[model samples]
Target: MPQAFPIFPLLSYDSRKNSMTEARNWADKKTLGGRGHFDLQSSPASLVLDSVRAGDEGLYRCRVDFKKSPTRNARTNLTVIIPPHAPTILTKEEGQPVWTMVGPYNEGESLTLTCQVDGGKPTPRVVWLMNGEVVDEKSETQGPQRVTNTLTLEKLTRSHLHAALVCQASNNNHSTPVQTIINIEMNCEFYVGFSCLKDNKRGMDKF
Candidate 1:
């Protein structure tokens, strides 16, 4: 009977640093020390990350170099998932009567709706929607994790009445986003003492 020896392939793992160098070798089975947050294990060859952070999310590549055989390589991506908190909506008006009611506003006025989400890792994306349609808006990042998106409606008309304004916060980790919805209100001048009556009638008609 002949004794058999287990042949192991040399494994090395690298992360992209910049466009010039391609990838910098961060961990290898042969070397030790100065790995920071990266851990390398032998035998089967595996890489372990310790105390992952938001900045650590990126592409990673692993290479297996054999002495006489062809060199083999594999690539993978690492995404850090941090679900954001529930979105909050704030309404602001200039030089006009502010409507605190859920749904009522005067026409020919400008209103600002600010959507905010606080405390999320990897920075969540905030989106604004009007009547289920995506609204073009820019999101601003505050500190490390907070995000704010503002939408301004100019020259408000009765066409906006009963329309739903939604703010949603999402990340890759969450299947469903955290959202808040506000229904536009018709001005009292339009229909005296009939606030939300149309909504109720529409709901009843569905049944």
Candidate 2:
């Protein structure tokens, strides 16, 4: 006579909740159904994720317990790929778009431009471009998924006038980049010498 094998109970570990749920009940409210986008299958016992999102990333463990026998378990990390959000470009001084004409900017003055992205999984890389030329600089992580990149112009010059400045944010998961562009403009004074001459003439007349 052939011996009968005892059936084992299947379980799944929810790393986000730090709890274990029966395989058949893996989609219960306390497990993944509350958040949706997840499902469990029997026969070979598999987990299915639909329309995955960044918040759904984490380590998932599967276990089986047999009566009068040792337990078996396996774990796999799930990473959801998401593209970065559109980047925002602004002047460091006013926190507004560099194209906004608030006031005149003098030549030879240092200016800072910042590019930021609100969210992305695994963070995103920001790159600055001047007239389509890449500006080699480092970017800082503001939060878990927020990132900022800064570019400094040591001296504003006539050549920078009408120049296009662009910021692009990207990640390995997506080839398309989120970007923003701004055109530069300089102060209106055409000749400093002419202004100085007018000032000197006023001083002579007062004497």
Candidate 3:
């Protein structure tokens, strides 16, 4: 009868630093000098990260030393993907109001809306959708932590009334995108015998 040896009895891992190896077991979470975020997989010789972060992205090396065979080295890279915060829609001039319904303006009035998102590893892209159709898609990076996109409608028409406007923010395909919505409300007009009539619904007559 023959005895079988285990696969890669002892495996060591390290992150690439300055193009050199620092001689550390990065996959040993319980080790004194280990990063504590990684766990070594014995059977398949893999490294598992418990919770990934932006700083943990880089090239990694695994060294497998066999008692009767030549030592083998393999390298792999890790990339971290961070999801962005929920999108916010700002309409008011002074305060940021998360309005579910905005308007009651004249049909010919213009409109402007701003969408903002914060804290994504690769920066989030913002887009505007009206009634399930893409109206605008543009994003600006304010800094390393914030991104913004603005939508402007030159004139609001009767077709915009009760229309759903959505602002979507996304950074990666793995996670669901964050979004916010607002419904447009236009002035109510009644026509009787070719004469236009306005009703005082929200305190103002004729929008």
Candidate 4:
């Protein structure tokens, strides 16, 4: 959980204290046999990588075949995520969505909209927008999962048909804000017309 005491310029470690010329990799492989220079207690035996860099990552494993009992093996995943850079958002329609079937029914409805982002240092930022407004929630990346956010709206109406909803993903990696636009519409005449009409009526009554 904590960053293994990183003193860089030093990584090899040992359990015993002896006057030896610090060694890097152990040839034994079985136990990475303690050489003369193995750092004793100076650093952690196994490095705890909170976040890995791009260079060397992915699954790292070690296998041991002892002459006595059972064999042993272990693996660890090292993934690199670079933060996306804050890029320009031109007109908010650069990477906008283009609906299929050329229909308007899909425009309004109860919906759960979400956005997913990948690659970033210190993690990319993901935010949801409803009717061009921002929604609040903690943004975190689980494992190699790209940043993602979901916005849920219940019972849709015509006003939300062709409404401008946005999902913004940003980090230091990209030079522009990545946005995905959602244009929702309800196709059912009974649902859109009757429901939307009554919903608006309630608003007027409130005043």
- The best candidate in terms of TM-score: 3
Order by TM-score, highest first:
3, 2, 1, 4
- TM-score on alpha carbons, each prediction: 0.50, 0.57, 0.71, 0.40
Clashes by residue pair, model 3: none
> What would you estimate as the lDDT of candidate 1?
0.66
**Global lDDT of each candidate:** 0.66, 0.68, 0.74, 0.51
Query: For residues 10-97, could you state the per-residue lDDT of candidate 4 as single tens digits?
Result: 2233323433454334433222222223334555335443333465455555444444668665667666656563322222223343
Taking all chains together, the TM-score of candidate 3 against the true structure is 0.71
The residue-by-residue lDDT of candidate 2 on 118-202, one tens digit each, is 7876578889898899984588998897899988888787787777778888877547888888877777447544232335755
Per-prediction CA RMSD (Å)? 15.3, 12.1, 12.4, 14.7
Off by over 4 Å in 3: 1-27, 30-43, 194-207
What TM-score does candidate 4 get on C-alpha atoms?
0.40
Stretches off by above 4 angstroms in model 4 are 1-109, 136-140, 172-174, 188-207
Give a tens-digit lDDT track for model 1, residues 1-207. Answer: 532222432233443344424644443334223333323445555666656566556666656655568978676787887678888777654323223234466887766777878977667889899878899457899778689998888988878877888888887654688888888886734554533333575565321
| Cα distance off (Å), candidate 4, residue 10 | 19
Off by over 4 Å in 2: 1-48, 61-74, 97-106, 188-207
lDDT of 2: 0.68
Q: Report the lDDT tens digits of candidate 3 across residue range 104-189.
A: 77878888878888888788889999999999998899999999888888778888899999999888899898898999989956
